[model samples]
Target chain A: MKIPSNLAKSSLLATGIFWVIGMTDGFHINMMAFMFISYIPVFVCCTGTILLTICPFYFFGETKHFSKRQVFQRFYPYYSIVCFALCAYGIYENTNETFLIGFFVAAFFTTMQSWIWFAKESADETV
Target chain B: MKIIITIIASMLFSTLFYDQHIGLNLTVFSLVTLVALGISNPSKLRMKETLIVMGLYLLTAILVFFNHSLLSIIANCAVFFTLVGSFSEATSSVYVKWLNGIYSSIAGTFHRNFEDKSENKKPWNEDVDVLHLIKIIVIPLVVVILFVLLYKDGNPFFEEKVAAINFDFINFQWILFCLLGYYLFSNIIVPVKVQPATDSDLATENQLKPLEPLNEDNLKKEKQLGTVVLALLNTLIVLYIISDIAFLLSNTNFAASVLSNQVHNGINALIASIIFAIIIILYFFRGNLNFFDENKTLKNLSYLWIFLNAFLVLLIIVKNAQYIDAFGLTYKRIGVYVYLFMTFIGLTTTFLKVYQIKNLWFLFRKNVSVAFMLLVLCSVVDWDAFITNYNIKNADSLDVNYLIELSNNNAFILHQKKDRMVLKSNQGARIDLKYSNYVSVLEQSNWQELSYDNFKLKTDIKSYEDTK
Candidate 1:
């Protein structure tokens, strides 16, 4: 499959961001490089590093089919749904109001650009 | 009869890896691989060949059953691999297509590669029918019941009494995070408009026809709405992050004393239930709207507002929040069990979803490779410092002395030597210190550093979290 130019750029940007974050966070890039050369088994660290690298590739590759506009539009509902599930789980496990409240706020902020935010105007106009 | 036989065979095999009973465990697992292979490829065999394969599979798996040193990780990998290979082979076989629709469905996956996607609008093959039949129908009805009766009490490693379960709310946390991520991506990260692509030729030809952008006032209004929506979502993200950190800070395992001080389980359960109910209601309405594009945003935002208001029900009933026990359940046995189930569910759905996405082969290969590498690494890594830190956090909250002593002990000393520690106790106990190395023995054996287990040894290892 041909990689779209936009997707390639996105992939590059995501990878660059990941690498920066990973390096700054003290991930062992050097160790990973060395370990990759030697067929020696270092499972967890190696896998983590590999995943960090490969995940960006998939993320980029996946967006090739959709236009940027389409991609952006598809994002919010699924993202919100996952976050909602995570926060709900947290509330259940922690049983802390503060934590639950915090998750709720996170969900809210994350979903701010969503169409649901302008429901009132639409409803009013209709009325 | 075929179904019953298959179920029995499956139970016999599953027990080889996971059964808690000794007699059945040994006999069943000893040749489980051979049996499973035979079951998968009985056609290749003459009657004699089938028996031999079954016997060999059972013998080999059972040997592992007895070889206490054999890691469950390796066995699990083997099992999944076998399942994949068998399923693929069965899908390709002529018999699969000839006898019933199962083969046709399986073969269709391969045939799909040849089909024109545009022409083939009809969906092909229920990928999970077999697994579902096994998990939902066969296992629960046949295997689990028989295992419960014959084995008695069922396998401790896999079995949890459904009636006694205290619904864990934590497993839902990851799902919530996914939802939040979706919102962030669609609404905040990128905004789209449903405008038609500009007609370039028309623009050049028709000088009199001016290009129309959406009205400036409309744009401004949309921008304002987008900003407000983003703000709300950002707040939600912030809250999730903050709460996550807070929960991590008050680590239950670390602060045993504090965790022990938790309120009654009933109150905790009730609070969680109420919150969950409210969230579920919100989610129900929230499902109606979406966040992707400008046109959709206006409509979807209305739905989101209604959802958010519905969520306020929990806040109004603040009494539910007051009942939290200061120190929650210390063991995390139930919590881990619940999370494990959720993880299993996650894995299962991920598999089903990949199939549904129609990119099963690509996603399967990528995810399996990553998953295998991660699981193995997690299994084998030396986690002394991490474990030590965790222990210190959990145990030191009450008695610093215990923490100090534990830190000074050989385990700590060994951990300090390298980032990854490998140490063995004077007793035949080996320590991997990273993920964890434990064996719960019914009887404390005489202390001697001994070789790896030559025979099957049944011992209960506490949850990795509770190892300290």
Candidate 2:
């Protein structure tokens, strides 16, 4: 379960951005440029923590024998749908609007990246 | 049959006793849940094991009656985890099995769509099945809507009856409770792979096996380095101990004056020194030191240092006690006591590891088990009430502001002592605001927040009001 260096790098970058945004919201930082931010960091922190915690289980050597591609094939479509629903709810809901939007955006990117990586892996296996 | 009985009993117990004393309610709930599980699967849990778990739960409930302190929360968590772990082990299960159960349950719901297209030909053939489902759905919908319409017609009796059927709003607490119930039920019912004990055995085996001795050149280098480090530490600690006796212990006034400045300032440094001593000992005794008979001096020196560490821990405890005497007790001060106790246990364990040649796992297991037991015992205490009572009676300077800010468990005590409180103008205003907030919280509290502590506080406040 060797994650491609590029994917790992991208995931790390995403984590950093999410963490920084979460800190800003948690601390109630109201810089003029960042006034648009709200509670999105709360959602991102939660989702990001989930992703980080799950990564080790997925990438460990004992799990490598399984078809890694099948993970995304089976789970990603449902994941994407849930993310879409959350995004819609975030936009529609009045409270913590910014935070919800931020959460959905991070979740959306995670779902997309997972789909792309798994799709490519599946294709490579077939080849 | 047993599971059904259990569920029915649980619902009845929760519903009937929902507004009663929280301790009794929680005890009944836990006992019912445990009984249900035991009766449903008598073969899986031994009578002794079941009794032990029940006793722990009973203890937790009893503690709630005493006070709603951090100890009770920790004790509750311990019981929960132990219950889950024991059930999981008894059921021959792993966390993966729980995950799989959740996954399958979700996936099974939508699985018909993924079935073969040929199966659709018989879809209408299963009209009877569809009708049964429709009845199941429509009956509930009709009953609810009918009741709602009837209530809307403005019949007071119907409205009263309808209102009595309390429907909890969909919220995080409700969801969490549901999830907890589901988790407990599922874990008890479903059996999975029992985790092999091989991993722990292998870990202990590795720790027990000594590392290869350093090469002669490296051994000489290490011996020289170890000698210098141990000698320097021993000399410094001995000198500090001597000075402590002369200056701190000999003069009670000096000790009192130092503690008056701050309670736990010097304790941190003492904790750090103990940690460093443990590390230093482990470093020198990495492998068997029998190869060099000369290393005996270092071992003796290390033993002396360990003794000194224990003494240092004692000194810190005495200092903390003096501080408590001058100022007052808080959670942090109590925590420092617990922390120092653990550190002393650790230092003793380290001595055993070095002298008795115990493995790292032995040290770890013994220390953790002791700590767990300590926590369980601690949970039986209501520290908030203890602190409030102690501070009020013992301290020269009373901080009513701090006392008022404590949990509702201490509310009754604070109210009783209200006449004795000496408050400044600003503090008086703050107390008034806090008192109003406390009253509103009591008024706003629902059955969910009902507990023995809160209930008692409420009663006391009511009695006070009645007298007024």
Q: Which has the greatest lDDT?
A: 2
DockQ agreement of candidate 1 with the native complex: 0.01
lDDT per residue for candidate 1 within B129-213, as digits (tens), equals 6656657874576455455444433565444453234435433333333443332222211111111211221122201221344
Each prediction's TM-score versus the true structure: 0.24, 0.62
lDDT of 2 at B89: 46
What is the lDDT of every predicted structure here? 0.33, 0.58
Ten-residue stretch with the least lDDT total in model 2 chain B = B109-118
Measured with C-alpha atoms, the lDDT of residue B123 in candidate 2 is: 42
Error of 2 at B238 (Å): 1.2
lDDT of 2 by residue, B1-468 (tens): 744664566355545343343444455555665666567666656645445655776678667545556567667656655554444343212222222333222222122222212133344344477668868996896576666755645787876665565433434323333433443344344322212332233334414454575476776778788878988998998888777656565666534457744346557667679879987877777675535556777778888888988887777777788778777898878988999899889988888877766666666666776776787888877776788889988987777778777776676666666666777667666655656676676566556444565566667778778866
Model 2 ranges off by over 4 Å: A1-127, B1-29, B40-44, B47-54, B90-180, B188-198, B201-207, B211-224, B249-263, B290-295, B426-448, B454-468
